[model samples]
Target: MSGSDIAGLIAAGVFAVLVALLAVPIVKLGRVFDELRSSIRTLSDGATPLMDEVTSTVSTTHEQLKRVDGIAANVSDATANVSALSSLVAATIGSPLVKVASFTYGVRTAWSQREDSSRPSGRRSR
Candidate 1:
């Protein structure tokens, strides 16, 4: 054959080898696409139930939070009432008890002084 014809034949052979190499990657890509499609279908099948469960749990949590808020308000009101009652009792009862204690101490001291003075100093009994 002539040099130009031989060069043309070589070029055709190179083109065919390149086409064969590209075909392998194309087949691998098709298999990857098929696997991706299957995985998407599986995810879609499970998503509905998972979404339902999440929504239910959220609603339950919201209701429990509301209950806790109500309980906290009640506890706050009760604490206020108890504090006011304690202050009132202290004011009403604490002052009288203090006065009585002071009066009793004064009386006991005066009686002791009188008994000591009635005894004669420097007089001995035989």
Candidate 2:
């Protein structure tokens, strides 16, 4: 064979070796991508059930909050009724009690004044 032919064969062999050397890393990179895809799919599969459970939990919480609001409204109404009832009682009983107390005080004052005037003092009147 000629020297040119030998040189060409050697160059082709070198290029083939280089390609084989580089192909190992490319194949490993492809495998890594495949594993990553599988992991993402698994995560998506797991998240669907969790999302459904969360949705149910949120709906139940909303229902409970509505019940609490209703209970709070009922309590507010009861408090208002109690306040109105207390005011009515105060108006009904408090005014008569004040009038009776004032009447007793006036009668006592008049009785004391009459008794004091009737009793003579030791000092003579000027």
- Cα-based lDDT for every prediction: 0.96, 0.98
RMSD of 1: 4.0
lDDT of model number 1: 0.96
- Clash counts per candidate, in order, are 0, 0
Weakest 10 consecutive residues of candidate 1 by summed lDDT: 117-126
RMSD of each: 4.0, 4.4
> Can you give the lDDT of residue 65 in candidate 1?
100
lDDT of 2: 0.98
lDDT tens per residue, model 1, 1-126: 999999999999999999999999999999999999999999988998999999999999999999999999999999999999999998998899899999999999999999999987896877
Error of 1 at 48 (Å): 3.3
Using all chains and alpha carbons, the TM-scores for the candidates as numbered come to 0.66, 0.69
Model 2 segments more than 4 A misplaced: 1-7, 101-126
Give the best candidate by lDDT: 2
Per-residue lDDT of 1-126 in model 2, one digit per residue for the tens? 999999999999999999999999999999999999999999999999999999999999999999999999999999999999999999999999899999999999999999999998798788
